[model samples]
Target: MKRPHLIVDDEIAVQELVGHWAFRAHTTPIQIFNRATDPFLPGVKTHLFRSLEALDGRGFRNPVLVITRWKIEPSDVDRLEALTNLKLTILVTWSGIDDDRVEPVSSAIAVGSLEVLANSASRVKKILYWRPIISGLNDTNDHFASARRLSEFADATVFTGLFYREEIRAYFREAGVPDLYADVARRKILPRDAERRILSHFEGRPIFRKTSCGVAFAHGVPDFNGHFGIREICDICPEAQHEICGRKHHRPDMEVVRSLARVVSLADLDGIEISDRRIEVSGSSEAQRYFMQHALNFQVHDRAQPHRQHRHGRAEIGWE
Candidate 1:
């Protein structure tokens, strides 16, 4: 029985999207925001609540991995801490250093939320998410400045390449918002120079790279999710890496990976030590499918095994 991962997103849709990924990973996906559902995999129990208050009513017996955004207040941290059975992880997605650069990523809430969360005495882990590194737009030296300044506030910084999806572009078009995807004509890979530029911003701070932004600090299949477990590309944030990321039961499935590596096109495995069960896999949707498929196969064999897995060390992907 893997520890249940509690998904806490204000948007039920986002929770469901990521929750389904966790579900496919064989990790328990517990919803913190209540929403009506259609049907999920059989024998999988689905838990939903109208609010955190509703969840609180049902006391947690096992230690839970509580996942939420950094746009939260210290009081929210306090409330989470009160749930002694829960371990907290907050993912911060805003990279605007100051007010001038804040507009694009700003929610209805104000910027500088990370600072407030940092100053609190609570033990929640913070992850700086510099995702969607839009080329020529938000990808600049200012990115480094913002990351350097906020790096102290977070437990680790995870940077990901920007890829455009048709559904998202269609939504932006329908919503009348300028699509950033149009800037690059919907390129799939994050520009290598842009990735380096963002990595440069984390000088003296712990940093890790992944295929998708915001994948760190959450529970799922790392290889499939496009999170290769090595900080070799960027300097590791020492202080932040030490913070507990609440993933104790999840471990990588080396045998499955070795088998998959032989059959699949893992271009990034060069010079990597797979015998240790650690390899740098290129971030691709096909790889994720392989990982997810392995996990599904386990369910057929024995639901208890739950299939494949992957994780990190200090400079590693930063999973607990």
Candidate 2:
């Protein structure tokens, strides 16, 4: 039996992890769609529906859809059902809204409002919601009823404390709302230890905490047998410099990153050999170019090798 296929449309890093996992599972074509112009677009939904329908019609029964915090409308749901003729599994970041005080009906109602078209045709199975007790937002009583309602209606519930609070706060600060951090810092939703446990559960491995740019980050345990590090594109093509790196240097494209993340996660779970053939990097673009040329000089060097030892630490990858 081959491993199931996962389609991920989130961050590049996440796609990489999922791809790594898929490769280990003996799944073919661990693909990533990071280039999706607008995941929520009606056109994208039609594209997915058509693609999934074609695959299912062609006997690809083992398929799974993995989305990260992307909202779906009701019309999209209807189209998906019409195409695939199967229930869809959805993963959502419940932390975006207050889950403690809102009733399930309220949450469902909110979703229904947003998904009027899709909701009319499809149903949601295995909804994983992560709830974190924010410091100042610890008053669960405010939203507990609604959350419980949603949980009861959900097929499967995976609860986690708020793991992205610091990241969210950092984003706000960078967007010129640093003071919002103060308010968030005062919440008492999920304690640091509990948050660690929640992350470990989904990752199925140990979790490490790191601080970067005044934000707290969590790194999942390395999937040693899966792709674990960034594949700096510069290492493979010295002249492929792009503006993405803010310099005349090449950087790993979004699709590559997503593919690696998926493969790593699947590999970690199934215990398979992780591909280490990724680009190497130095401190700066100039340094990276130098290293790329140096690596290419070796007669046996393929420019891409399984440099497993140089994988990114958790904070750098931002799984937390």
Candidate 3:
């Protein structure tokens, strides 16, 4: 029932999409235009310009998250800075993986982008998105050192795992690339050992377990996802961010929760559960759940799929 309209054509279509979505009071373009190819700039891939051009001047203070490892010039930063209304955060993805087969784009490109965004673009926030740290590939001490050095360039850093799905495994097999993980996972595969190594390496840094944490930290705002409720997830958060989130954290009223549940048209309102950690609802689409979540600035979970304790958004592959 998730009818997401894909706007891939002209500017008019983009404008129409933005116009329709602009009315929402809290629209976090959280995960969008990950690797958009820039039509104007050759050898550059970024949906940043076209998408942001449409979003700019819309008078929306929505948080926009654009994750990319592509080319982003200083000129592009200027264009991004011009957009004064939107709270934009660019997460430059760099894992230091040198394997041409696994990652076609060099890590240097993303490193350069991070540095540029950090040195320039005063208003626009940046996060050193250190991710997809595969074992024996980019998980070396050198990699960590390089990423640690790069972390200083951004407002914050978030280390995450690889999306080693069945399809990805198949592709790797076809390409004669060795299996990245012992088995594929529903979530990104960040093993316990790898996580420990990362934590140890990134000790005493502005790091986060979640992307929203880094994004919110960069923008100096509370986590719209309301992750502070999950104590384990917030354990890695900086004291300043933790305080900021704590100040804004409040258990939402049941009436408001009921209102959100109704917006999703849940046939049984009795099934809705709202704890400090998250709002749990059954029989709702992803779009409906996310709508309520972004609107309430709280975590919303489907009762059918319960998240594990202390391992909020992580894959069970490593923990087990």
Candidate 4:
């Protein structure tokens, strides 16, 4: 059987990574379409386009378009509805408008909340969720709970994150709110909790499970401390999982570790590789010091093999 053709929205780095990994594992050609340039690329079966009209000119079949930034409006869905063989996959951070009419052509999944969608295990072909630790205000618990619920409903869960326990925790700490850990721990299993609520929202649904992490930089910039630089100062609490890190300072040469190996979008990978690592180093200077101190203490008792690492190999990085 031919490998499924994956179409990722404009996220050149993610697209590139997915392309490389897909080709290596499933012989799939991961295509990319920048929504900023062309919003209707999903309707085009062949040839890339810079405008939606140009894309509509081609009759595409079962084409999957991954959206990262551009919002899908009613008009956009109308154009997509015109395509008979197109399949739309929207990878968004939060649920905004509804596109129920375009249900067949488009399906929306949160980057951190795939588990919520996975409850419909039958309808979903594959699931991709990443980011184990969501470091935000207390409200983020809802997001995590939703994701976990979706995972419960998936046929097979493919959970992928940068690092399992340590890195996730570290990321939270660097974000200036380590309390999120305690929050997730407190409400992980509660039905009313965010994770459980997400599952409940789509229970008994037929959906495949696929999860991934380490794409925080694709959408935004990082701080000086290699943490999400964006500030969440609302009463709603922080959904740290969707926050971007390391935009303030662009570190052309830095190394990131990919603990798990999987095919990702090339655009996603490039975003990580090219993001301002220096910002992380700088923004979290104080946090890094504290982390190092804690790491020293943990090292005395922790014994896990270092799994993966990605290096940019440059110095003099800065943070925003």
Best by TM-score: 3
Q: Could you report the Cα RMSD, in angstroms, for every candidate shown?
A: 11.4, 16.0, 3.8, 17.5
| Model 3 per-residue lDDT tens digits across residues 1-320 | 12223455536755666566323734655445443432323432244465666666557677888777777888888888888788888888888888788887788988888888877879999999888878778888888989899998999998888888899999989888999878888878777888788889999999888898899999999988788888899988888888999998888898998887776687778888888888888878888777777777788888877788966677788788
| Residues forming the 10-long window of minimal summed lDDT in candidate 2 | 210-219
Better of 2 and 3 by lDDT: 3
Give the count of colliding residue pairs in each prediction.
6, 58, 2, 83
Model 4 residue 127 CA deviation (Å) reads 9.7
Model 2: per-residue Cα lDDT over 1-320, one tens digit each: 12223344434443354355222221232222324442344445444555555544544422234333345665556655554432234433354353323212223433433334223533333343444434344324444444444444333344433334576667655665424223342222244444343343424221222111001011111111122123331222112111222231233443443344343332221222223343432222332332222222211112223222222221112122
Instruction: Give per-model TM-scores.
Output: 0.51, 0.39, 0.90, 0.29
For model 4, how does the per-residue alpha-carbon lDDT over 1-320 read when each residue is reduced to its tens digit? Answer: 12234444534533354454222221111234543333324443222322222332333322243433223343443443454432333343332213332111222434323433333222223233323322232225454455445444323222211222455456556655333333222111111233333334444432211221121211122211233211221111123432332223233332321111011111122232223211211112233333321211111001121111121111111100
Question: For candidate 1, lDDT tens digit of each residue in 217-312?
Answer: 332222223222223421343433323221221334656554555444544444223322233344434434344334422211112222234222
Overlapping backbone residue pairs in candidate 4 total: 83
Best by lDDT: 3
Steric clash pairs (candidate 1): 144-201, 155-240, 206-236, 206-237, 224-288, 252-309
> By lDDT, highest first, what's the ranking?
3, 1, 2, 4
Local accuracy by lDDT, each model: 0.42, 0.34, 0.79, 0.29
Error of 4 at 288 (Å): 35
